[model samples]
Target: MRRWLVLVSVAAALAGGCSQAQDASSIETTARDFFGAVSDEDGQRACALLSSDARESLETGGDSCDEEITKLRLEGGEAGRPEIWGEQARVRMGSDTVFLTRWASAWRITAAGCERRVGEPYDCEVEG
Candidate 1:
């Protein structure tokens, strides 16, 4: 989860956009698109939305990223309010929380299917 936090922080920092509305909208769009790709079973598209580290983590054990990612069977839900701070961002949906990082000019998913755990880092299904 430390890895997940770091990634979120990076993106949140970059999220210092011209306006809060724009930043939030961009972040929300990325989150929705990521989950949408997952729900569609379009592993290639879903993997494209991931941060480099996340893609690396998902492609472990000699499996191709597209193949392995599809197997995760992540659930998609309606996006809710996003919590943004510095360089980290967490967007909560009805069923999942997604962590994203800003890499260059785009936002990428660092973790997904996350749930808060008391006295612990988020328990995430997909993380870097």
Candidate 2:
């Protein structure tokens, strides 16, 4: 079950629509860019893709916190394409896994209701 989820998530991340280029890689790329910005401590850029709560967390926690999040990389979850029709996205970077969302063919990081770990490698939430 987990493996299937991984496959689907990866497929979702890599594809998108341009009309919209819905393939898993497209979404993954969005996640990749977003993470890169965050790692660079570009909160404004990262926040642009983050959920409302994520934005709030960064606002309250400040630059240090945001930079920490940025450090995480978007690893796998690509079957060489992108697909839409989902509210969430997942990708792996090194030993890390990231969750993102879809807006048409565009992807953004999901921060609302997602549990964050301070000074730790993972900040994730299980979908209910």
Candidate 3:
């Protein structure tokens, strides 16, 4: 019974890990499309890449993804596409590391720092 329990636990761990990896890859693709849109400086198109809450925030909460993109563009602009892990991602933007994520196929910029977080700015930077 103990051996069976152990096997079950292992299987669960493996399944969960695989799911996380798939989510990460999906996030990576979303991030690529998002930053690609940003590189083009299309706020509306880029905003389309953001989650609905993020979009609402941008439209109503007085948040500023455009400015963030512009600042990133000025600070030498983004270095490369983000590498996502689970619901989080990291990107090098000149001298800064930009945090990112995917919310329903939309890419949201959630943080800007060296180390990465796991869960608001951690959850998405493109906050309200």
- Candidate of highest TM-score: 1
The candidate scoring highest on lDDT is: 1
RMSD of 2: 10.7
Query: Which tens-of-lDDT digit does each residue in 9-107 have in candidate 3?
Result: 999999997876666555555555666676777776666656555555545346465645433442324356557666667676555555666665545
As a whole number from 0 to 100, the lDDT of residue 94 in candidate 3 is 52
Model 2, CA-based lDDT? 0.54
Please, what is the whole-model Cα lDDT of each candidate in the order they appear?
0.84, 0.54, 0.58
**Which window of ten consecutive residues has the lowest lDDT sum in model 2?**
74-83
Q: Mind giving the per-residue lDDT tens digits that candidate 1 earns over 43-128?
A: 89999998988888887788977888888857868888787775578899777899988787788889988888999999988898
Reference-based lDDT, residue 24, model 2: 69
Provide the TM-score for each candidate, comma-separated: 0.82, 0.50, 0.54
Decide which is better by lDDT, 1 or 3: 1
Candidate 1: pairs in clash: 8-88, 9-87, 9-88, 11-102, 12-86, 12-87, 12-88, 13-86, 13-87
Question: What's the residue-level lDDT of 21 in candidate 3?
Answer: 66
In the order shown, the candidates' Cα RMSDs to the true structure are: 10.3, 10.7, 6.0
What is candidate 2's lDDT per residue for 19-90, written digit by digit as tens? 344446666676666656656677567667766555555543455435544554433232333334566655
lDDT of 2 at 113: 26
Runs with alpha carbons beyond 4 Å of true place in candidate 3: 60-126
